[model samples]
Target: MTWWPEARDELARLWVEDTSRQQIAEAADEIDRVLAVDPEARGEPGPEGFRRLTIRPLTVQFAVEEPDRMVIVVTVRLLTD
Candidate 1:
């Protein structure tokens, strides 16, 4: 399976910082699943970019750049509506 070292490390660092490891792990799993199914699922115009994934109540974004892949996650702080 294709793996992203930076992404994995980022998640690990988040866990180290007392972030929800379970949540991050779950998200990573989901991301892996999607990528496995279709590496080009979130295909962007350039070699790297952010692709929003459906992960209820939270906004999960992944940035994939060659030689330095990474995933940036932004969670919803509050519900406006």
Candidate 2:
């Protein structure tokens, strides 16, 4: 399982500031699970489409571009609502 440098750094920072780091870690693990199940699961199509996988209150938006064999995570954030 590989992550882009930016995503890695963002997650690291999230862990640093968020008191619920463990929860976020679990959410990340769930994202891995979704990836394992469907590497091609790009979320709802749109102008800026990405695979939207959620672990409870957190939302992970990403896209799987096969040619490069990369999971492009556009954003990882906690859902306020």
Candidate 3:
């Protein structure tokens, strides 16, 4: 599993903006749950060729590169209303 720059930035931004340690813990737990999944089972079909997982207010976008057997996290962002 690998995180793209945008995913890292978004996670950083979320941590900075939300000072509650509990919130951070929750997010971290959710992220870990997602990561622990088998790459083949991790993603649900998404637009174009991507796949996505929902973690509450955030949506984790990713792509499965079968040849490499790796999951590349494309981005993490707040869900729009």
Candidate 4:
């Protein structure tokens, strides 16, 4: 069961800072790996078909489309520095 985890344009803003960008990028990579393997088993469920996942300073909202074999990440946020 492979899934393609995609980040939306809305997440680009969080990568502006050099420091945060590296951290976020690393986290994003890990996110893709995890989501690709098993998205439904992870993350906290949210309303309106959205799911929330937090990787340290980054929090992301993604929706898993089983039929499409994709996890569409809709939003991203940095919790701290």
Which candidate tops TM-score? 4
Q: Is candidate 1 or candidate 4 better by TM-score?
A: 4
lDDT for 57 in candidate 1 is: 23
Q: Score each candidate by Cα lDDT.
A: 0.47, 0.69, 0.72, 0.72
**Which pairs clash in model 2?**
43-51
Local accuracy of candidate 1 as per-residue lDDT tens digits, 30-78: 6566655444455333323556565422234455545544433322121
Return the TM-score for each candidate structure.
Answer: 0.47, 0.72, 0.73, 0.76
Q: What RMSD value applies to candidate 1?
A: 6.6
lDDT tens per residue, model 2, 1-81? 456677777777887888888988888887777676556643455346556766764676677777765666666777656
Query: Of the pair 1 and 2, which is ahead by TM-score?
Result: 2
* Candidate 3 residue-wise lDDT, 10-52, digit = tens: 7778878865546555765686567667755765878878888
Query: Candidate 2 vs. truth: CA RMSD?
Result: 2.4
RMSD of each: 6.6, 2.4, 2.4, 3.5
lDDT of 4 by residue, 1-81 (tens): 222233445456667754677777888778777778678878999889888988877788878886875777777777875
Q: Tell me which of candidates 2 and 3 scores higher on lDDT.
A: 3
Q: CA lDDT of 34 in candidate 3?
A: 79
